[model samples]
Target chain A: MSPKSVLLWTMQAAVFWLVLFVPQLIVFLLVSNPPTWELVLMVATGVVGVVHTAVEPSWRYRVHRWETTPDAVYTLSGWLNQEWRVAPVSRIQTIDTKRGPFQQMLGLSTVTVTTASAAGPVEIEGLEHEVAQRLVVELTNTTQATPGDAT
Target chain B: MTTPAEVPAGLPAAPEFTEPLQEWHRLHVRMLVVRPLNEGVAMLVPILVLLFTGNGEKWRLIASGATVAMILAFSYLIWRTTRYRITEEKVELHTGLLTRKQLAVPRDRIRTVDLTSKPGHRIFGLSAVRIGTGQQDVPGTDGLTLDAVTQQEAERLRLVLLQKGTAPRAVASEGESAEPVPLPESEVISQLDLKWLKYAPLSLSGLVAIGAVFGVLSNYADDLGLHPVQDLWEWLFENPSLALIAAFLVGLAVVGLILSVPLYILQFWNYRLTREPDGTLRVQRGLLTTRSVSVEEQRLRGVDIQEPLLVRAGKGAKLAAVTTGLGSKGESNLLLPPAPLSVAHQVSRDVLKVGSDPTTLRLRKHPFAALRRSMFRHTVPWVVIAVGLAIWAPSWAWPIPVAILPFAALVGWDNYRSLGNALDERYLVTRNNSLVRSTVALQRTGIIGWRIRRSFFQRRSGLMTIGATTAAGAGVYHVTDVGESHGLALADEAVPDLLRPFLVDSTVDDQAERNA
Candidate 1:
C-alpha cells in the first residue's frame, strides 16, 4: 500500500472501531453510573488501542514496500492480513477512472481495469489523477504491443 | 474519427421504399387491451363492492378521475409511439413522444432478425421485426413496427440484411471463380411434434391453480391476525423427519412437473430449428402469437450434454448450448433446451463447427483441483449452519447432522462432476455446473481474462478453481475438480497460451508461477 493508502486504511479501521464501540460506551455511561465492569471494559479497550498503535510502525513499513512496486499496481487491502493484487500494465483491456465525493475532496481517483474475461473487474483505489492517467496510457501502450504476455 | 456529417454518403434511397414498413397489426394496442381487460375486472370488482355497500361522492369522483387519466395516458402513448425508419447502415426505432427516444442498432451487431405478426399485427397488415444482439435485454422489446408491408417486401428486407456481406464478394467470385459455394437454405434441425406439446397443458393449469390458491391463502392470512408463513417455518423444522420427507416428495413432484411442462410445450409449439442461408439458426414457436428468433453460428459459445440420474436410463441425453447472446428471457443464455445428445453433437460440430480435438475435449472437464477448493470454501458455511441449528434446538440436533451429510456429499459430487476444460488454437471450451450441467465454448479472441484461485484448504489439498471471464456477460465458466498440481499446470499452460496476448501481467509472467 502507498503511504496514502496506509493512512486511509488506518482511518477506516479507526472509524469502524469507533462506530462499533462508542455507542455502547455512551449507553453504558448514561444507564449505569461508575460501574466497576464498565470501568474495566474501558481500560481493556484503551489497552487494545495501545497495542494497535505499537503494531502500526511495522505495518506502515510493509505497506510502503508493497505499494511502491514499479512493475504493477495494487488496490485492495486488508487489516490483519492484506490482499495485494498486481496487474501488469499489458493485461488491461480498458481503464476507467472515477472520482467519488471523498476521493475528489482528497484529490484521489479510483481506476478500474476490465479484462475480457467474465470474472467482473479489478479496481485500484486512491491514486492521484495525473498518476492514474499516466498509468492508464502506459499500460494501454504496453498491452497493445505485447497482447499475449498476460497470464 | 469521421464526423457524422462528413461521412461519405452511399447509394440513393429509392423513393422512401414506399413498401409497408411492417405488417399493419396494432401490437401496442393489443398489449394495452389485454392488460386492462384481464386486470380491469379485478380493479373494478372492489370499487363495485364499495359502491354497493356504501355511498361516497368523493370516492366516485376520485375513481372517475383516475380512470379518465389512465385512458388519456394510454391513448397518448399509443398515438405517439408510431414510427420506424430503416437506414443503410443501421435500423432506427423511434418511440416515446415525451422523451422521443431513438435507438440505432448497427446491422453488423445484429445476430438474429425475427418477424412476428400477432393476431392484431396480422389483421392490421403490420409486422414487428425483432433484432437480437449479444446484449442482455428482452429480445422483442426493441423492434421495428411496419404498419403496412407486403410479404414480398419483408422477404426482400430479410434477404438484403442476410446477404448484406455477400454482394461485393459475389460479384468478385463471378469474375474470378466458376463455382461459388452456395449458401445453404433453411436447414431444419428439429421440430416440436404436436404429440409431445399436449402432455403438460394440464400441468401448467395446475401451476396457475397452485399460485392462485397460495395468493388467496396469503390474502386470508393478511386479513386475519395471523403472521406470514415465515413465522410458521419454525413449526415445520420442529418435526425434522416429517418435514424432510414431506419437502422431498413435494419438491420432487413439483420439479418433475415443471420440467415436463416446458419440454411438452416445446415439443408441440411450432418448435422448428432452421438454419438460414447466412449460417444463422432460427427457432419459431408459439401457437397463438408465433415467434421466431435467429442466432448466428459465430455467437454460439459451447454445447452442453447432461444426463441426470433420473434421465440416465433413457437412451437420449439433454442438450443445451451457451451463447454469447442472452436468451429471449435475458436470464439464462443457454439455447437448444434439452434436445437429444446426437442433435446436440451435430449442432456443435456442424452448426457451430467447433473443433473435435482431444486436447479441446480434454480441456473441457472441470479440473479436479477445483472440487477440493470449492468444497473447502463451501463446507465452512454448512458447518456453521449445522452447528447453529444444533445449538438452537437440541431436540432437532440429530436431523442437522443427517442434513449436513447429504449437503456436503451433493456439493462435493457436484464440484467433482463440474471439472473440465478444453482449448484449441481458435476456441476454448470448459464444462462445469452443480445441478444444471453446462459447457461454455468461447473464441480464443473473445476472452478478456483468466483467474485461478485456491483457498488455504485447497492449497493443502493441491486443488484450485480456474475461471475464465468473458465480455458477453458476467457468467464465468469454472473447472472445479482437479488435483492441485494438475490445476496449476493447466492454469500455467492455458492462461498464458490463451490469454497472455490479452493479459498484461508482465510482472508475474517474468516470475515463475506461484506454487501456492
Candidate 2:
C-alpha cells in the first residue's frame, strides 16, 4: 500500500462526511425553536462524525492494499450495490498518469489503463509517483513480452 | 518521442518542383473582385425586395451599408490570406491576415485529388484541386486551389499522385524527361453489375426522408409564432401518451419517405464503382454534380451485412463496410450502401482480405432466450406506457392495454427471429435487429474488453447477456439470449481463447496470411 493512497482516502472520507452532514446542520441552526427530534438528530450526527473520523485511517489502509495488489484491480463502487470489475494487468493496453490540483496538493497521482474497447478506461486513483511510474513500466514490458495475454 | 525525420531519399532524385506564382496572383485578384460583386448582389436583393414592399429608407440604407462593409471586410481578408508551398512530402498552406494559420497535409493520406472548374475559373484555366481523405470535417476544404495551371499539367499531376510509388514533382520541369515506371495493376475480382447499382439508392432515400421531416417541422414552427410554438413544444415533451401528436408525426414520416424516393433515385442514377490499379476501390456517383470517393483496403474496419425485413423476404441482403473516415453528414462510416449477399461475402474475402474457413462456426439461435430478453427489455416499456395511459385516463385504460399487446408481441417475435451469433478462430460475428437486421464482424484483435451481465431474475432463470467492446466505435454488441452456463463459459474461456491468436501479440496481416 502506497502512503499517497492513504492520504487520498482520508481526504475523500472528510469530503464525504462534510457533504452529507453540513447542510442539515446549517438548517437545524436556522430554525427558530429547534424541536426535540432535531436536537436528537444533531447529537446522533455528531457521534457518527466522530466515529467516521476515527475509522478513516483503517479504511484508507484497506483501500491502499486493494488498489496496489497485482492480482487484479477490482472496482466495487456504486450507490446501490458494488459492481465488481476485475481487469488483469495483461489486458491493459496503455497506462496514463494524471494529477489535478487536488491530487497535486496531496502529492498523489492517478493511473488509468485503457483497453481497445470503449466501456471507458479503468482508473486507479491516488498512488505515489514513483510507484505509478514503476507499475506502468513493468506492465508495458510484461504486455510486450507475452503474446495474447488476457487478464 | 521520435524526432521528425526527413523523407527517405531512395527513389531516383529529381529537382524540386515549384508552383507558378502568376496563377495564384491572378486568382487572388479575381477572387477579390468577384467576392464583392457577389456580396453586393446578395445585399441588393433584400433591399430591393424591401423597397418594392414600401419599407422605410432608413432601414434600407442601414442594411445596404452593413452588407457593403461585410463584403469589403471579407474581400480584404481573402486578398491578405494567400500563401501556398509545394514540398516533396506535403503541401503547406498559409492563410489568415492578423493571426496567421498554417496547415500541412501529407501526400500519402490523400485518397483522391479532383480538379474542378466553374465557368469563370474555366475561362481563366484556373481549377480548384479538391483533395479528399474521406475523413475531413469539411467536404472540399482539404484540397488546394491552383490558380492558372494548364489542364495538361493538372492531368499530369493527378496521374503522378494516383500512380503507386511515383513521387509528386513540380510541373515546371517538363523539359527534363522522367521515366514513368510501370507498376502492375490491381486485379479486379468483381465489378458492380446492374443489380448492385439498383439497390444503392434505397438507404439514400431513407436519409432524405428524415431530413425533409426535420425541415418541415422547423418551417412549421416558424410559421406558428416561434415563442408560442416553443412553449407548446415543451408542454408536449412533458406529456408521454400523446397519441394524436404521435400519429401526426408518423403521418409526416410516411409522407417524407414517399417524397424522398425520386430524389434518391435521381442522385444515384449513374452509380459506378471501379477497382483502382493501386488496390483501392473508387466509387463515383451523382447526377448533376458528380463526386468520387476512394477507400483503401487496409483502412476497412469490418464488413457489415444487413438484412432488412423487406429485403429478407426477397432473399436479399445489404452489404457495407465500416471504414476509418467521417461518412456523409458526419453520421456513419458505412462505405457501401447495399450489394447482393453473395457479392458482399466475395468482396469481404477479396477486398477486405477476410478469408473463408470451411470450419467456420455456424450462428447459434436461442429463440426462447431471445424472446424472454426482448420481452424484458422492450415489452416492459410498452407495458409501462399502457399503465401510465390507464392511470391518466381511466375511461380509455382497458383499450390502451389491449392496444399495447400487439406491439410487445411483434417486438418479441423480431428479437427471437433475429438474435444469433457465429464464432470462429479469427472472428466473432453477431447478428440481431428488430426492424433492420445488422450483422457485426469483430476481429479478435479488435476487441478491447468484454463484460458478462446477469440480473437476479436472469440468474435464477439461467439467462445472461455478454457484451463485447471494440475501439473502432461505441455501441457494445450484446450477445443476448444465452444460457447462464453458456454465457459464463464464453466469457471465462471461449472468448479469451478465440481472441488469443490475434491479440496485441500478433499483427493483423499475419492472420490474413494464415487464412490465405
Candidate 3:
C-alpha cells in the first residue's frame, strides 16, 4: 500500500468521525448539567476513530493478495478475518477497472470480476493503473476464448 | 461441448423436422378476437351499469357502438403489428405499434417454450408462447412471446425448436437426407392421479392462493369504489355474538377453502409429464388455462425433493428440477407435482436414472455443538417472552409461551434432525430444514468450487459452514456448522485436491478429531 492511500483513508475517516463528533461535543459543552461519563465516552470515540484510521489501510494491505492464472482469478483479502475466492475465467460475465480520486493520486486502480453467482463480485484493489488495465484485457480475452461456459 | 445426441433410455430416436417454417407469422387471426372481446366487455360494463340505474339514456346506445369500434380498431392495429418467426439458429419476435421492439434469442440458448392459454383462447384452440432463455428476463429482451397462436401450430413450434436446437449436428445432418422417418411415440412418464389432490390442502400454495383470492377481491372492490363491503361489515358488527362470530370466521375460512381447492385444481389439473424420444420432458396441465412446458434432458443436473411441514404430516412432497438458467422467477420447475412420498421418490429416481437414488443416501449428521447452540437460541426468545409477559400482561400471553416452549424445543430438534450432507463419486446430497425440508441431489460434475465460512462465533466454537458452489440449483448447497476440520476435509474429499494449501499445519492440536 502507498503512503498516499493511507493518508487518503485517514483523511476520509477523519471527516466521517468529525461529522459525528462535532455535534456531540457542541451539545455537551452547551448543556448546563453534563454527565462525566458522557464526556469521557465522547473523548473515547475520537481516540478510537484516530487509531482506526491510522492503522487499518496498511494492516489490510499486508494481508491482501491477488493473482490471475490462465483459467482462473484468485483473491485473498480481509483484516480481522480473511476470505479466499476463486473465479473461473469461463464463468466471468465482465471485468471492470475503476479509479476513484484517492486511487488516482496513488496511481492505483481496482479490477472487479463479476459472475452470475449470488456471492457478488470479486474485487482486486490497490493495483497499479497500468497493471490493472492489462489484467482487465487479459481476463476479457480468456473469457471470450472459452467457448462452453458453465454459466 | 454437445453430447452425441443420445435419446433418454426407453425412448426411440426422433425423426428429423424441416427448417422451422419462416416468415413473420402473426399467430392465427382468431387471436385478434381476444383483446377486442376483453375491451368490449370492459366497455359493456359501464353501459350495463348506466342502463341498470336508468340514467344516461340519450347517448348510451351511441356510446356502446362507438366503444366497440374503438376497441376493435385498436386491437386490429395491435394484431397487425405482432409477428414471430423461427430461423435456423434463433427465435425472433416483433411487436408494438408506436414504440416497437424486436427481440431475438439464440435457438440453442432457449431453455423453455412455455405454452399457456386462457379459456377464451382455449375455446378457439389458441395458446400464448413464452420462449424462456433461462436468463433473468428483461421485460422486452428476454421473455419473447407470441400472444396467440393455434394450439396445433404452438405444438409444432415447440417440437421443431426443441428438436433442432437441442439435437444440433445430428438433426442438421439428418434433415439433409430429407427422408420421411417414422416418428417415435413419447412415453407417459408420470401422470398425476386424482387421488393426489388429497395432498393439495397439505401445500402452502393453498394458503398463498387464499391470500391471492382476497387480494383480487380487494383490488376489484377498490376499482368499483370504497365501502363495497360496508353493508356486510355493518351487518357483521350489528349481529356480533360469540356463536355468530365463530360462524362468521368459519364461513370466511370455508370461502378461503373453497377458493383454495379450485385454485389448486386449476394449477395442477391433469398434470402429466411425458418423455419425448428426443430427450425432452413435456409437462401438460391446467383446467381453465392449459399450459405446456418442456425441459430438455441435457440440462438436468439433479433434483430437489421438498417436504414442507404440512405436506410431511400427510406423507407427501414436491419435486423441483435443479437446472441452471431456468429464470429463477416464481418458478419451481415442478418435475413432479405434490404427490405421495413414495411416488415422489420413484419419479426422482426415474428422472435422474444415475444408478443410485441420491435422495435416499444416509447423510452425515452435524456436530452436537451446533444443535446445542441452536436449541439455546430457539428457547431464549420464548423464555424472554415468558418473562416479559409474566412481568407485564400477566393474564393472556402467559399461556402463549406455555405452549411455545415445547414447540420451540421441537423446532430446534427438527432443525437438528434435518441437518445432513453426503458426497461421493457421482453426486453430492445435502438435507436441511427451516420451515420447508429440502433434500438436494446435485451432480458432483456440476460443482465449481467450495466456499467455507467461519464467522467470529463459528471460529470460537471451531465450526465452519461449507457451501458446494455450482451453477445449478440455488448456486450454493450449504452444509452449515460442521467442525472446522470436518468442513475442510469434506471440501477436500469432494473436490479431491483443492483445499490443501488453505489448511493449517498438522502441528496444531485442533478440535476436529473426527475429521479423519
Candidate 4:
C-alpha cells in the first residue's frame, strides 16, 4: 500500500461529508433567519467530519495489509471494521486491476481477485500502480497453471 | 469436474432402440386434450361472465365455443412446432412459430432431471420433464422443459441424460441400441409416517399462507367494498379492552393452525426419499401436482438441517441438500419436510453416509463477551426508543417498549446460545439463528475461500465472523461472533493451509504494533 493512499482516503471522505456540509454551510451564511438548531447541527457535523478526516486515514493506513503466497492471496483491510479474506490460487476465477481517477492521480491501483462464490471478490486496495499490475499478472499466471473450472 | 462417467444404472437391459432416432420428436398427443382443457379452465370465469351478462343469448354460447376452438387450434400449433431432440452431446428444443427460439443444454451439463405431473397431465399418464443445470439467476433460461411426454418416455430420457455411460451408443431415440447395464436397486431412505402430521400445525407456514391470502384480498378490498383492517382498527379503538384483543388473536392462531393441516396434507401427502441405484437421491412428493426431483450424489456438497422456532419447539425439523444445480434453493433441495428431529438427523446421516451425525456434534460456543454484546445490542435500542418516545410525548404507548424489552433480551440470549461452530472429519458445521435455527454441515472439500469480518463493536469485543464461500448451497455459510483467535483457527483448520499464511499471534502482534 502507498503512503499517499491516506491522501486519497481523506479526499474521498471529504467529498462525502462535503455533500452534507456545503448546503448547511450555505444556509448558515446566506439565510438570516436560519434556525438555531440548524447552526448547532452544522457545527456538530463539521467537527465530526474534521476529526474523522484527520484520524481515519492514518488508522486505516496502519490496519490495511495484503500479501500473496504461491498457493493463495490474503488481505486484511479496514480500520474499525476489519475484513480478512483468503482465496486459494486453484479456485481463483478472475483477476482485475482498477484505478479510479483519484487513485490514478496518486499513481495507486486496486487489485481484485474473484472466485466462483457469490460471497464477493477479494479486493486489495491502494497498492502502487506498478505493483498492482505485477500482482494481477502473477495471479493470472497462477490461475492458468491450475486446472478445473473454478465453480 | 466433468460429469461422473459410470455404468448407467436403472437402464433397461434390452436395447430397445436398434436405430438411434436423432430426429426431433413432438410432444405426446395426449397434450392435445390436456392443453385445451387447461386453457378452457383458465377462461371459465370470463366465459361465465359472458354467459350471464348476455341474458341467455345464443351468441354467448357461440362466442365461448369459438374461444375454445381458437385455444385448441393454438395448442395444436404449439404441439406441432415444438420439437425436442436428444443428440449425442446436447438436448435441443426448437419452438415458437412467429418468433423462433432454440434452447440447447449440453448432455454433460445436465445436473437434475425432474418429472412433474399436474392433475391435467396425471389423468392421461403424462409428465413434464424439466432439465436443470447450475445456472439459476434467470429461471426459465437455465432449464429446458418438455411440456408433456408419456411417463415411460420421461423416465427413459431422465436415465439417458443423467447417465454419462462408459460407452456412448444411442441417445434418446425410441429404439436406439446401447449397451445394457444392470438395473440399480432403489434403496428407500425414509418415507412419511402418519404421526409426522402432528408437527404440521406447529409450522408457521399456514399463518404466512393466510397472510398472503389477506394481502391479495386487501389489494382488491376497495373494489369489494370491504375494509377488514380498518374495521378491525375501529373496533379496537372503540373497545380498548385488552382481553378482547387477546381473545381475537387467539382465535386467529387457532384458524392458522387448522389451515396448516390441510395445506400440509396437500403439499406432502406421499413424501418419500430414495437413493436410486444411479447415484441420485430422488425425492417423490406432492398430493396434487406429483413431483419427482433427482439430485446427483456427485454434486452433493453438504446437508443443511433447519429448525424453525415453532417447529423446533415441537421437536420437528426439516432437511435440505446443499448440492449444486438442483434448482433454486429451498423448494427443490428439500429432502425431508417438517418431520421429527430424530428423523432429520437420521436422514442427514444416511444421505452423507457419515457414521456420526455432523450437525449433532458438540460445537465450540462463542466467548462470554459475545453474550454481553448480544444483551447490550438487543436491550439498548429499545431503551433508546422508550426514552425518545417519553421525551417526545407522554403517552399510553410508553408501556409497549417496556413490555418488549424482555422479549428482545430473550431473542438476544437465544441467538447467543445458538452461536456455535465445529469442524468434523469431512464437514465444517455451523449453527445460527433463533427464529430459523439452521445447522449447516458443509463439506471441507467444497469450501473455496474464507472471509473473516470484524465490525467496530466486534473488534472491541475481540470477536469476528468467519464465513466459508462455496459453489453450492447459499454460496456462503457463517459462524458469527466467535473469539477472533478461535475464528481464525477454525478457518485455518477447515481449509488446512488457506488461512495459515495470514494468522498471527495476537499477543505478539499487539506488542509489535505498540513498539512501532
Docking verdict class for candidate 3? acceptable
For model 1 chain A, give the 10-residue run with minimal summed lDDT: A63-72
Candidate 2 docks at the CAPRI level of incorrect
For model 1, residues B1-516, the per-residue Cα lDDT tens digits are 111122224632221112223432333444444434434545554455445545666777687568746865764575457555555557666667667866766766665566665555554444455665555423345344443244444544555454445332233433343333444357777666444333353334345555676687676566455667767677666655776878867875686567656545633366676777566666666554555566666666555565443333332344444554443442233334344455556555655654562223665444445555556655767777777777776765646665776777676677566557766666666666554455566555455444555544555555555565554544455655455445545544554544233233423543556543
Best by DockQ: 4
TM-score of chain B of 1: 0.68
- Please compute the TM-score of chain B alone for each predicted structure, in the order given: 0.68, 0.63, 0.80, 0.84
- Show what share of the native A-B interface contacts model 2 retains: 0.17
User: Interface RMSD value for candidate 4, one decimal?
Assistant: 1.9
Residue B16 displacement in candidate 2 (angstroms): 15
Model 2 chain B lowest lDDT segment of ten? B15-24
Off by over 4 Å in 3: A1-65, A76-84, A100-107, A116-120, A141-147, B1-16, B36-77, B134-142, B165-176, B222-259, B328-332, B376-406, B497-500, B503-516
Which regions in candidate 2 have their CA more than 4 angstroms from the true location? A1-94, A100-108, A114-122, A126-129, A139-151, B1-57, B64-177, B183-254, B308-316, B327-332, B339-343, B346-350, B353-361, B366-370, B389-405, B448-516
Question: How big is the positional error of residue B369 in model 3, measured in Å on the Cα after superposition?
Answer: 2.8
Report RMSD (Å) for each prediction in the order shown. Answer: 8.4, 10.2, 6.4, 5.3
Per-residue lDDT over B1-516 for candidate 4, one digit per residue giving the tens place of the 0 to 100 score: 222235555654432332324899999998998887666675765667667666788999899888878888889888989999988779999999899889998877777888888888889999988897755334445478898999989888877777664324444453433344445568999998989988888887788788988886675564456798999889877778988979988988988999998888877889999988667889999887788988878778899999998899999999999976765633888999999999999999999988977999999999999898888888899999998888786587677898999999998899899889999879999999887889999999989898888999998888988999887778789999999777888888888977765665445786798899
- Give the least accurate 10-residue stretch of model 1 chain B, judged by summed lDDT: B11-20
Candidates 1 and 3 compared: the better one by DockQ is 1
Question: For model 3 chain B, where is the 10-residue window of minimal lDDT?
Answer: B502-511
